[model samples]
Target: MDFTSLSLAYPWEQLPYALFAIILAFTIHEFAHAYVAYKFGDPTAYQQGRVTLNPVAHLDLFGFILIILAGIGWAKPVPVNRYYFKNPRLAGVLVSLAGPLSNLLLAFLCFPLLLLADQFGLGYKGIIELLFMIIKINIVLFIFNLIPLPPLDGYRIIEDLVSNRTRAKMSQYEQYGIFIFLLIFLIPPLNKLLLGPLFQYLVPAIYRALDTFWSLFL
Candidate 1:
């Protein structure tokens, strides 16, 4: 999920592809959240137009810039009212998971196009690059959103799973969640310790599985 390489190694010409990928990935991620929340009886996001696929509805200015510059950022979070759900805990977890899962779905959908581009040596190199960029950004979004920390889908899932008392304790420290998240990425040792294995192993494994599955068809 580390995009440091994209920023440093890729030329300025590729920025448009990266930006397109980011908009699509982030839009789908947030839309999944809003749609799921709406399905589970929360109209909050829907009423606010957060359920739309339009990137403008989901993109946050600062977050979008950070994603382009640093490769780590977020979209406008879909608003949800858990009180509207009959089973708040379960619904909450599902709603929280929707965003990351949507990104994974996007990555899965893009894999075959990427494979075809490679297999046929597509003359339009830009198209191939765009597909690759889309896949990479979506996969990164999937993995990064699932890290169990505040302001992330994983943390929301955890918050739903825990008891009320534990959740209350978590709430007390919610203000520091963003700081902690930044520390994990900003501190090299911490980033290596927490996300190294995930990016190194899990991401590759996912691609391998996708390749194996798609190879049968292509």
Candidate 2:
């Protein structure tokens, strides 16, 4: 969960870019949830003003502080009343998928800008660095939130897919899920197992794909 694990060298110098990227990523992510839920006949989040782009509506104070200090954080979850949906299971899955997919979309949109900056040698190192950070952070958010564990969008998707009895069994251990999530990162072997493929293979592969695709135009 540490941003430093993303190999962001010069932590202090990159802090501003990281903060900006985090805010954008978290805001768009949460807004997507709210928007999709509203469209699916759940106005719960929209009624609470969660559908807006304002970061204030989405940023959780403690999570924001944790992210600033420790590089791990989260936003306030958008409230959705599944009872309003005609198909609660399908709507729930889409609502959960919305947040992570928004992040991936952000990364996809930003990749071209990063490529353009590199192609033109913009000379504005700060701008180039900011774009890079945005792309990287959004990609990280997209992948991280999709990990099938409790408190993540992936788990919500799973909950929607599973039978009621299975979901009830999952709920029995829901309270301890966050603790287990943290333990995975805190334990060295587990951390390596989780992050190794993500950083070594998936991330680089994504970047290469983006590069190849964007190189066609830029």
Candidate 3:
């Protein structure tokens, strides 16, 4: 509750800010999908009254807890009925990609904030810490969601790209999806294997970009 009061180290310090980033990212991510789906004529989310930005309506208790413990978890998915779409396959792709793409946009937005802070000589540790979290969370959400795993947005996008036969076969894995997902996430080798690029490259690039952008603007 006391965000600034929280103390965390160089690596772990990003946790609190990550918490806020995830909440904001997922809220907007899901909201955008819902809004677009509604605009495109799917009323399921609207009918369920999920068009609001109040994250309480979207947060998943288990997922929220996982963020504190495991560091990655998801809010409740915004309900979408693809049958309501005029072009189900294409619509599904956009809807699925929307979540992670929103996070990327968030990361981009953070750059300007960092620059603004720097301009005022306000690149305090707290602000840097917050920007770090923003970068990490956005990248994690982008790469993690882009994984072609079941029920994740990335998988839907993949499904749109693959053959119909594969899609049909893959549907069977849906029921067991989350367990498989967590198993992979918790498996150290597999987890690192997945995040190697994210930590080694993507994150550093983001930090450098923000720093450079700030230098230019400030």
Candidate 4:
């Protein structure tokens, strides 16, 4: 199937590159969550077979389709049993943080390689295009998941830090968060207030940081 047909900007030839980026981003993010949970003594994800890099292990069919259609999506959430942790609070925070952190780390590593590909002209056209998609997708994944909304990694991190009563309150709204998210995107004013700065400012800031870091060594 021609995935690029879904994209209005890029040519159809770039479909493979975009698909690779989405799969890699989703796989690593979920794997990091599962791995961290296992490291912290939670065996739930391991038992459920999520502690692997296989994209199928992480991808949610509906979410992947949304990614292709709208430039954003999600993966299956790794099952984590925090009660197994020696210090549930610390372990919980770390495990929840791993997913987004993995994406940021990926963006960091890809930036320099992207520069080299561009400078040396190594398969410049396709390779550079692939790396750019990979970097952008990873950054978007990292930032998007950091919103302090229920069911997202960011809210889990907050759940670990905030009082138990507050966590309970947040948990009550968890089921409605996705519906609320869709509404935010559908409503222009809400979308502008919430997502506008993310794309316009934060994303560019990260790119600038990547460029500055590589410039120092080059």
Candidate 5:
């Protein structure tokens, strides 16, 4: 999606902060997936070294560029083998949820730090901006990946919830899902109409949750 629709004002000075935030968020997200998969008996991701916090291990070159420019992107998907799980469906669902859940948890964990930065004005301008960007971008990544589209973590969750027949039908369209996402995202009216509300509500709501937590102590 275009950055404009998301109202992502990327000033030149803020690029470094934004870039760091994306890398940190993406790394944690993918690592969570790999870690959960390994715990659930899938050794593939762990064996491939995906269960680490290294951003380079998870960043997809094109996806990272898109995240910098367009406000939404992906990382390398952690590989999971159904055969490894005792209950494949449950394991799959938990593994899929891990990525976005990790982002949400990270955002929550950053709330106090964000409040401290605002209250005490800790660090220089870029440092403060980086902290805020970390919270916002992690929230965005969490919500965006839960859109129930193929190749996204959400779809795997959806797959577990649906009937076998429906799952088969949805699987058939998986290959074309990214193209469909691009078609909707690149078009102005469609992007604004569809994703705009998500930005307006979903994002602010998350921050508000963090705010509510901060209010308890502040």
Candidate 6:
């Protein structure tokens, strides 16, 4: 899973821009979560002042490094007390879903500029690099966050859809969530056994979809 086999540049020359887009997109995602949570009556994130685009407000150091290494990255999680909401389970799921949805929205919003560059063939090297990083990062962010593991957005989405009994049962696993996540990252057998097959399909699907969208207006 090193950069060498990913066929990406060392990202040496694009390091600054890559890092900036990663930080900016990640911060925006988290900020959207906090903002939506606040709107739905959870003041926890607001009190902590997480409802802003300032990367410093939402940056997680280890998470940032993972972005540099092409690992699925994360931002500081915004706190939300679902109890404060009119419909706790539903609002909670919405807040959880907001982060990745924000990233997709950003990709689509930035789509036109990339297409413009592609259309005119203006500095193809730079534009293609920008498009690649932005689109791939967004796709990875969307898929990684959607994994139905504890403490991830998909868990909440599942909670919202399933019975209260099931939600309560799953809640017990939250304490070990990060450990489970690390195991998936560090244990070769599990990564090879589970993640490898999943990504074999997702990677190409994401790229094809991105290409389809680009061809529409480029």
| RMSD, candidate 2, Å | 3.8
lDDT of each: 0.88, 0.87, 0.76, 0.86, 0.86, 0.78
Which digits, one per residue and each the tens of the lDDT, describe model 5 over residues 73-131? 67888888989999889998999999999999998888888788878877676556888
Best-performing candidate as measured by TM-score: 5
Instruction: Give all TM-scores, in the order shown.
Output: 0.90, 0.90, 0.83, 0.91, 0.91, 0.85
Better of 3 and 5 by lDDT: 5
Residues 1-218 of candidate 6: C-alpha lDDT, one tens digit per residue: 56445533235687766886788788878998999999998889999989888899999998788757745566788888888999987787889899988887777666667777777887556876777677666766777778888678887788888898987887787768768877986677887788887777896786787668878766
For model 5, the stretches where C-alpha displacement exceeds 4 angstroms are 1-9, 123-125
Runs in model 2 lying further than 4 Å from the true structure: 1-10, 123-125, 187-189
lDDT of 4 by residue, 1-218 (tens): 96444643234576688889989999999999999999988889999999999998999998887777665567898998878999999999999899999999999999999888988997646888899889988988888888877668888899899999998987888779868877776677988898998778888889899989997886
Q: Give the per-residue Cα lDDT of candidate 3 at 49.
A: 72
Candidate 1, residues 1-218: lDDT per residue as tens digits? 86545553235878889889989999999999999999999999999999899999999999888866765777898889989999999999999999999999999999999888888988376888898788877887888888888889999999999999999999999989979999998777988898899898888788788889989999
Off by over 4 Å in 6: 1-10, 70-72
Candidate 4 segments exceeding 4 Å error: 1-13, 186-189
Give the clash count for each candidate.
0, 0, 0, 0, 0, 0
Ranked by TM-score, the better of candidates 3 and 5 is: 5
Candidate 2 local accuracy as lDDT?
0.87
lDDT-based ranking? 1, 2, 4, 5, 6, 3
lDDT of 6: 0.78
Q: How good is model 3 by TM-score?
A: 0.83
